[model samples]
Target: MGRDLSGTIRSFLIILALSTCCFTTAPPDLQARVEQLEKYYVEIKEHFEAKIIDLETKVVRLEAKVEKQDSLLADLKKGHKPLKENVDINQHCRQNATLRTCHEIHVANPSYPSGMYWIDPDGQGIGDPPIHVYCEMEAEQSDVKGTTSILHDSESQMDIGNCTEPGCYSRPIKYYASDRQIEALIQLSTYCHQNIMYHCRKTPLNFNGIAYAWWNDKDGERHKFSNRSTTCDQLAYTEGYDLQYVVDNVSLPITRIHFSNPFKGFGQHQVSRLRCRGKAKTEAMPRSCEDLWRMGHNLNGIYSVKGAKQMETVFCQFDKRPNEQDFQKRIGYQDIKTRPVYFSGEGRRLFMEKLIPIPFDHDVVNIGGAMDSHSGVFTAPSTGTYFFSFTGLTGFKGGVVITEFTFLSSRGVEEKIMKHSTISFSKLTTFNPITVQSTLRLQAGDKVWINLDFRNDATFRFVDNTIFSGWLLEEEI
Candidate 1:
């Protein structure tokens, strides 16, 4: 519309000039006609300029609304409830600061002691509600320095009397925080610690290779007191000491401590505390290297982050700053020595819908840890365009190797983005390999993977030299 109005104005000016020239060839009222024409042109120009200004203003407003709608849609797709009207998501924290975790609060205010504090992770008005968590601020100053948030702390000492029989165990540790919150905290942490102390008297930690006591760690992995060589010996002394053990797995948040009172009627056994705390990798608790870069960190090296699932060590590519949103996200896979066989037959045409995902089990370059080598799926760290390439050799059995590339959206919708097939005319044909490459735009939480077709009733296998790789091309701000 603006373009059309400008064209109209230009044509009017041209016609007015032509009229003025025609009148100049005649006599009397030429000067008067020119003055009137000039006045009319000025009025027309002002009218059109005003309309253009109004259009531009409306366009800006519409763009802003669209951007907001997009953000809200993304949150909803991630299973978040629509926010209440007029409520800003980032204002849930103290003083309207964007503090995502207790660690960030501690970093912002170093004087704040260990206590219950409210954190608005996943922002406010989303599915995630603001949760009050106990932050163990002392851990930052203690040994193994980092900020710690207490996920679970036993209320009182638990006693396990000598029950020589089996099946004696304590309850699973219940956490105050939600599972999502706990997972987020773990992702933000570099390490976790749990304090366990046993009050013992004239009783053995274990006997005859049977453990008298054990505790389940955060991941539910059981660790016996007798398993740690000197742990049982340390407990044998007259006075018990606090066994501050660093938790091996920081992925999970809760733990359960168990003690089988095998020394019933002989000695006593009691658990002092089962306090679990996660020490953050950094005070900032940035989720990605892009976050660190945005926070003004210029160093380029490996850094820990709260990844999509757990804590991930990713290389920060700060040396190259294509844009403010350009944080490194690259992954590569190779050394897939094992051959996976998929069988398909003519009658199995419908089975093509369920393509077998290829497992790129080795990673040569995983900068952002976005690719899961085990699952052969690349999860987008953020909404962005990414470059992906896969090269593989077919097995000696000359058969059709149909490969399908797929994209799983955040909304649980799967779309076939690309498909390639390598065929052999005969069994005598050898070295039939296939390669697929494409640039894909994916939203955060979207997954991409390569699948092989097993719909021809033949065994299909990709050779050992197969390579699958991808990297972030550009991020959407």
Candidate 2:
């Protein structure tokens, strides 16, 4: 037991020694110890606070950068939007052989023997060359009256075919020709292609029937004639063969040619003079008289006959009549002027009040009482400079009452005041006229009103009535 007690005492002594050592190392004054602890805490807090402040600044900068990046991305998206592809003939010509060939062919045959040719660099060729042909026929005025025969041949001396029977003789003979007939012979020789078909059942005593008749088959067909049948002696007929062919073949652009020689001299109206300039593919070639006439109408501006001076008067007047739908686009009747006024009063006694509610259309209302009063208001339908005029009179003492005249903007905001007019009792019963002029910067849908304040005791009668007239002088800047 004694040994155990000694061991416990020794352990307690060791613990006491350790406690004494800790107490001796600690600061003695509370204020000093607190100050050291506070210093450490402040240093640690400042370090953490600095780090947080830097992080916050970085966050703000990052946000701004993100916003800028987003704006750039939106701009890039807008800039990358696709654009429309414009048609480029140069590119198409380089890529398409038909276009190239058509250009080459046009260069080779610039002008036809008897027509006009307009070569548009951007226009597409109708089709392959020599595939289509145009045949023009005409009946000449001749004194002889035998069967008019036309023979086709590969050569000038060679005979291909001719009209049989009564020899197709007539005062005004009609004619027909085929593209195959022309193509077959035109390919061989120009002389062989001279033959054209003409047939007429009736034989006339005089050859003064049809001065001209002809036909041609191109991408489209054409026909022309000269009639000396009426007083005007103008060229006239029913639906022409050229017009019919053009209407039937909507796909092809057709042209017509007309020839008239007021002077019937052989030298004046030679075949060369009758020939027209023509365009096929991109080439200009000499065209027949009929083909030239057809194309002349298709071309812009005026055209005249070659050679004969009097025949040059023959020109085409393009149709310019307006269609029904075009006429309907116009609204309101013209040549009518309307003046409207407003009055304030009950039943028959109502007198002209301030001009408020200017009637767009004229409307009549009966006044009720002897001392009735009313107002008038005029609203401008559009923005423009305007002139205003009004006329009226007073018939009784204080009868003619003065009213406030004002103009209002589209927002119902008053813009200007018109002159205030007052009349004596004696003058009230008399007729008077008022006029005012003012410059207004009125937006569309603005309004102008006249406010009339009449006394109950005053009895008045208006002469020539009160009316408002506004005329647009000019557009306001």
Off by over 4 Å in 2: 1-351, 358-378, 426-430, 455-457, 461-463
Range of the 10 consecutive residues with the lowest summed lDDT in candidate 2: 265-274
RMSD of each: 30.9, 40.8
- Tens digit of lDDT per residue, candidate 1, span 106-215? 66665444444566443333335566554455553544322444433343344454456532746566655665555544544455444455555434556667666567
Clashes of each: 5, 74
lDDT of each: 0.56, 0.33
For this target, which candidate reaches the highest lDDT against the unseen true structure? Answer: 1
Candidate 2 local lDDT, residue 214: 35
User: Please, what is the TM-score per model?
Assistant: 0.39, 0.23
Task: Compute the lDDT for candidate 1.
Answer: 0.56
